[model samples]
Target: MKTKKILIVGTGETADLAYEYFTYDSEYEVCGFCVNRQYIKENQKCGLNITAIEDIEDKYDKEKYHLFVAIASSKLNYDRTKVYNELKNKGWKFASYISSKAFVWHNAQIGENCFILENNTIQPFTKVGNNVTMWSSNHLGHRSVIKDNCFITSHVVISGFCEIGENTFIGVNSTIADNIKIAKDNFIAMSAVVNKNTEENGLYTGNPAKKAGISAKEYFGVL
Candidate 1:
């Protein structure tokens, strides 16, 4: 089989890790990096030229290489979602990077442009939606649904039958009990333990988590 070439659409820390994962673990060879023209300071990155998005197509045709948006979970993953959708609408293809060491059930359904890292246990009948990022060592329980553009950080434990809403960010070491439904655009802060259903845009924290005074949108300055 021919190894696919990939162009990462950021020059940040996430992108650096993505390049390493894709290059070493996956069948994709990262040929270069791309970012908005204003942010281009270096002539090259990781021994490849950093091309501006404005000139990307002319230099590296989309037909030959796919893209991966490697931005972190800033603004509850709004920025990454925007870039992924924008690129898709413009006819640029995307590539998902799932780590080799991750344990995924046979019946699990994962979608496009996902970045799944090592030790993630995506259990039976799980549905992971498009453009989701599951960082290292998360336990996604059976029949759980992770919606599009959500970010699940490392070492989190999401129990069975849970539904994580779109544009949500589950922070590092968080725990969601069984049957919990985290609402859209919400932020579950680091190590928070959520046992009940969350409201849309709610900021949840603490054990048996309660909604904070400020909305998740307000806390992230996304609106």
Candidate 2:
């Protein structure tokens, strides 16, 4: 078996959780951690040296280490996405982290840099695109399509064949009906039940989810 060295970016709760998960798996050897300069209060995390992103490739060779950005918030995820994209452009590879406890179907197609947390049930033929984050216990129904850079919170239920567009954030406990089309940059608030198609950049909420605002950018930062 080939051993892979990994560099986890960030030292927050989510990053620590990821470190624990990957280290116990044995296949991945966590080399160290890397965070933005502003977030690096100390020089180490979990007893391993924590370097800034600017100095990471120097110590761990961009081609030799797999980088995983473990920031949790939606806005931070967006910022991390930009930083990762810049790294990718410089020929550095990024890695995805799928929890061993997650139930992912064999036929599911998950794109690069995705993070699927514990208890996620990704059914057969589901297509999940790059930089997506699916929090714990979410049910991604069969044949569902989740596009790039989306943040799906815990307990969300996406029915079969539903399409979640780019840069959208699906809040906790939300349920999207089967075959529904959620357009780009939308925000579906917590506990909402989406029964119909949504327009691009819309903000939706409530039990059958109606359009609540123009776009999430009006409230949250721009995607």
Model 2 poorest ten-residue lDDT run? 71-80
- The local distance difference test score of each candidate is 0.94, 0.85
What is the TM-score (0 to 1) of candidate 2?
0.93
Please provide, for model 1 over 1-223, each residue's C-alpha lDDT reduced to its tens digit, 9 standing for 90 to 100: 3389999999999999998999889999899999989999998999998999889889988799999999989988999998888889989988999898999999999998999999999999999999999999999999999999999999999999999999999999999999999999999999999999999999999997989999999999997
lDDT of 2 at 186: 87
Best by lDDT: 1
- Stretches of candidate 2 off by over 4 Å are none
Q: List the residue pairs that clash in candidate 2.
A: none
How much is the lDDT of residue 223 in candidate 2?
Answer: 48
Residue 79 local lDDT, model 2: 71
Error of 2 at 61 (Å): 1.5
Q: Give the CA lDDT, 0 to 100, for residue 31 in model 1.
A: 93
